[model samples]
Target: MCPVCGQEVESIYHALFKCVGAKNVWELWEECPMVIGTENMDFSNLALKMLECGTPRDMELLIVVAWAIWCSRNLRVFEMVCQGADQVWNHAISMLFDFREAVKFCGLGPLACEVRWKKPQVGVFKINTDGATEVDGRWSSIGVVIRDSRGEVAATLCRVLPGCFSVDETEALAIEARIILVRELDLHQVIVELDSLLVVHQILAKDFNGGLGHIVHGISGFLEGFHS
Candidate 1:
């Protein structure tokens, strides 16, 4: 049962874009590029298309709207509280305004920051991974991209994991999977990157305590074989 509306099975796309609650919030931004009746597009494709076609301000608002939807979903799922569409819209707008103001105050120009890829050292490969979960905790996926020193593709892996209770567990599972891949390929010297700071810290700490402690412990053992 979906936590928000108790309808169809919850998925990342549905939770973020297509649910009744999500649709209401998007309709609030009728003038936004994403709400212009684009059909049959998944969340990842929609996000990429927005980045390709949207202006800087459009991009900012789009990100805020997505975040607002996620926050609203969390509130409903965790606290059994539902926020109105207007409230969600207002919150996203306020957040975007504050972000823009902060950028101006710092004299860093209009956009917040642009992220790009950097190559690893000559003998090392880099593995980047990220995890996503549905708001209702019904589904989850992990993505991994491996690149060599010359910035050439090595391998890519994306897999759906058994449902978990929290996103941190999903992230920890992703790191564990990436380590397995490294071991299978006999890649002794490598650098792993992930967006979850907590997972990185846990891996570096070499001590594990949490729902993901067992997974992190496995990763710690794998790390011991690599040359520092």
Candidate 2:
């Protein structure tokens, strides 16, 4: 019997593909043809078929998801912990996105602008924020590092958040938390920096009432307290 779920005999197919937990993860990835057409085939056959039928990106995602599921299984067995299907799915997609970004950067010739930290203006404080989630776990964390114009750390905060639906949501949470931290510190003149350009753009736009509308609204409210 499988030590993790105890629902069936331990086998490669059962452990990786057929278990209830694995099925939930596969169902979330229904956009993938391999996931949509899962059959009672052996593990190797299923993997080979995925490679043969999937596009390059699809294949990459498939591999990442499989690896995530395997890692989740191992974590459950050894650490007595389990990750939900949504968490596993989000983790796989995030990994694939990071891999693709890295490949794109490597493909571009040397002129690509390198990112480096710069100090804030003389009277302004800078808050750098970031968020990260675990591939084989459910929770996410947001961190904020506040620095003065002299490039010295003023304050720092780290928080563990519940499982986020996507990286964008996690980033939004980070910015929101940063705003709250600024308010608590009474830092009037401040600048915020984060790696996610999408979140920054969304915040800059005047009318952004999409999925993260509430978070954007919260950020706007907090910004009013800052020195213009």
Candidate 3:
């Protein structure tokens, strides 16, 4: 029904496309490549198509705009949260700039962009410790924490391994992964510590007789000549 007639209810299509209420939104999207003309666009298809196109920066902008549009739409309908076009534009601007700054600081340039990896300065040796609980004779989870000599946290990592494994195996695997990651960053001078004495001893001995033999073998080989 027309506004003059005072319609009782409005459909999403009418509100999003046909209504005067949405005219400004359409115009805004026209300027925003991410959500422009996406009213009737299939969400999945649009996402994939956009992903296929554009550099990393372009994709980042697209993601922020798309998310902002969806947020604005949801705010208007279900939550009864509504804001003017200026507010929405401000929202988009804030999101875009923030994400842009983050990506830049993280040293993640454009997709497939030429990036020279810089080695981190080695201040002190660090070790990331981890644990995995046993449940029902099957492995539950892995918890990892990295710390330097001063007891300052360097990093922490955790994840559930596929299939079942013992706590010792999980700990060993975490230590091995940390060493590889550190080596990739080209920072080799550091001490590795683990609460699990067996894992630490195994690592020192360069022995892979444990359950996670393959992983230990590879890691030991890589760090074999490094000063402990």
lDDT of each: 0.76, 0.77, 0.56
Tens-place lDDT digits, model 3, residues 135-187: 23344466655555566667666777764444556666677777776676565
Off by over 4 Å in 1: 1-115
Q: Which residue pairs clash in candidate 3?
A: 125-190, 125-191
For model 2 the local lDDT of residue 196 reads: 64
lDDT of 2 by residue, 165-192 (tens): 4566688899899898888888899999
- Once fitted onto the true fold, the runs of candidate 3 whose alpha carbons sit more than 4 angstroms away are 1-122, 137-139, 148-151
For every model shown, what is its TM-score relative to the native structure? 0.52, 0.72, 0.40
Q: Residue 195 of model 3: what lDDT? A: 54
Q: Whole-model lDDT for model 1 versus the true structure?
A: 0.76
* Tens digits of lDDT, candidate 1, 59-175: 778778888889889977785656677657756765565566656756865454654789999989999899886554456799999899999989999998865334566777888
* Model 2: colliding residue pairs: none
Candidate number achieving the greatest TM-score relative to the actual structure: 2
Relative to the unseen true structure, what is the C-alpha lDDT of residue 195 in candidate 1, on a scale of 0 to 100?
71
